[model samples]
Target: MKVRAYGKLNLTLDVLGRRPDGYHLLDTVMQSISVWDELDIQTSRQPGVHLQCNKDRLPTDSKNTVYRAAKFFLEDCGLADQGVYIFIKKYIPSRSGMGGGSADAAAALRGLNEMFKTGLTTEQLMAIGARVGADVPFCVMGGAARCTGVGANVEPVAPLPDCWLVVCKPPAGMSTPRAYSILDQYPLSSTQATPRMLEALEAGNLKRVAKCLGNRFDETIRLAPVRALKRAMVDAGALGSMMTGSGSSVYGIFVSEDQAREALETIDSMGRTFLAQPCSGI
Candidate 1:
């Protein structure tokens, strides 16, 4: 089975609090984006997972989310004796906070379930995926959702208003763990971003949606290049701009593709940029 793993953007991300297990509770609106990675999977007579990725730096062992997804799915389905092979053609940049890894893992689970005819429902896949990563459930469901509680609780919402997005990533990558550690050291700036974002989405107001774009990471860790990229997007006619995920990648929402393309050119020199739009859930 072949599956596509679409990337995601954070229209609003807030850290509600930390749990006793040290997991930070989150209340955020996540949207699927046109950016994606593709995976080809098939069952093998061998009794272990085999993974091949286009990116050499990516791990292919148990540490790899793709491998873990396969292992866990097989074990869950009483097919642990079965083996699978997966080849990932990656387009999404890693550590961009775009849920690339989680998307890939979700895709792997979807493909494996189909390959083995496991008959697992979407909810079942999501439950298994949560063990792999918090963003996995949302990615499995696709479209737009308001996710909370370590990202395991996903509430599907109205799709984002049709718009173009200029997504740019600086060369500096962010470590999610390190960012969370740093974020804990300081107080937050705003906690209402999710509610405002939900209101904007429900109204289908692109401008309001853009204005509601906010990330707690942006307020807590003001990376120099990230701020610059956000400015460039606004200067090039974006409705509003903000950093997505933890730190590195920033996106600007635009009402039209032409505006987004122009903004892309404006930021072309500043970082690795892409012209993207909102994507529906699987």
Candidate 2:
């Protein structure tokens, strides 16, 4: 079985508060993009899960979410005797706030279910995914969504208008834990951009959507490369641009593919750049 693990962008992220358990409360809009990694799975007579990735730096053992996801799914379905080998063709950059790892884990859950003939519903898969990572549920239920409660509570929403997305990631990666730690030092605010962004999305007005593009992390993490990338996107005629999720990767919404391609050329040398579109559905 083969699955495409798509990357995601946070159209609007608001840190509501912190939970007693230490997970930050989040109300955000998440959208999958065309940029993705691929996962291939095959049944193995061996009674254990195995994983391999194109990226040598990533762990292929139990530490990997993909491996854990397979184990979780099998155990949940009472099919531990079933074994599978997972191979990942990685494209999405790690630690770019792009949900690359989460997406891969989601793919494992999906692919294993299909390969093993485990008739698990989408909700069931997402429930299993949530246990692995907060973002896994959203990746399982792809496309546009309003995610809350540590990003596992996903509510599908109206899709964004078809527009080109220019995603750029700097060489430096930002750790999510570190980003949240920095955010803790700052005072919380009642102001939120998610509500306005949701309204704009429902209205299908790209201009309003652009105006409401925001990420709370932007106010916290100050990096010269991220700032430069955002500016370059705007100068290249993007309707709007913002850093997705915590840090590092920044994306711009462009009305025209031609314009987005032109923008990609301008920033290609700055960092890894990908031209993508909003994924329409799961």
Candidate 3:
């Protein structure tokens, strides 16, 4: 089974309080982008999971989300005796807050269900995915949604208006845990980012939607390359630009593909770049 796992972007991320379990509460609007990681999985009678990746640095053992996800799903299906050989071809940049690992985990669950003929519904798959990662539920469902409660609770929302976007990851990546730790030092903002973003999408006003772009983590992380990427996007004609998720990667909402391409080139030297649009769920 071959699955294309799409990466995500946070148009608006608001930090709430933290739970007793140390999980930070959040209200973030998520959208799946065109950037993706491809997984080719094959089942075998041998009772163990083997994994490989194009990026040699990425772990292929239990440390990898893909391997863990396969194990979890197989155990759930009462197929623990089954084995899978999984290969990942990565396009989405890691450690950029793009949910690359979560996406891979989600894809493994979905592909395994199909390959083994397990009739798990989307909700079931998403529920199972949540155990693997906080963002895995959203990645499993894909497309647009308001994710809250440590990003496992996903409420589907209207897709963003058709448009082009440019995403760039700075040379240095941000640690999600470290980013959250830094953000925890600050108080929660009164600004209602997700509500306004929902309204903007519902109204089908791209410009208004662009104005809704926001992320609390971006405010906390003072990375120079991130700021430069946003600045170049704005100067090159982006409607609005901001860092997605925690940090490292920044994206710009553009009026046209041409403008998006220009912004990509403008900031390409600063880091890795991708030109994409909001897409639907798997």
Clashing pairs in 1: 142-281, 143-281
The TM-score obtained by model 2 is: 0.98
Q: Residue pairs in steric clash, candidate 3? A: none
Q: Write the per-residue lDDT of candidate 3 for residues 198-260, one digit (tens) a residue.
A: 999889899999999989988877788888888888899999998988878999999889888
TM-score of 1: 0.98
Give all candidate RMSDs, comma-separated.
1.0, 0.9, 1.0
Q: How do all models score by TM-score?
A: 0.98, 0.98, 0.98
Per-residue lDDT over 1-282 for candidate 1, one digit per residue giving the tens place of the 0 to 100 score: 779999999999998889999999999999999999999998788898999999999999989988998899988899889888899999989879888899999999888888888899999999999999999999999999999999889999988898899999899888999989889998754566999899899999998898888899899889999988888888899899988889589999888888888878888988788888898846
The lDDT-based order of candidates, best leading, equals 2, 3, 1
Task: Tell me how far the alpha carbon of residue 243 in candidate 3 is from the true structure, in angstroms, after superposition.
Answer: 0.5
Alpha-carbon shift of residue 225 in model 3 (angstroms): 1.0
In order, candidate lDDTs are 0.90, 0.91, 0.90
In TM-score terms, candidate 3 sits at 0.98
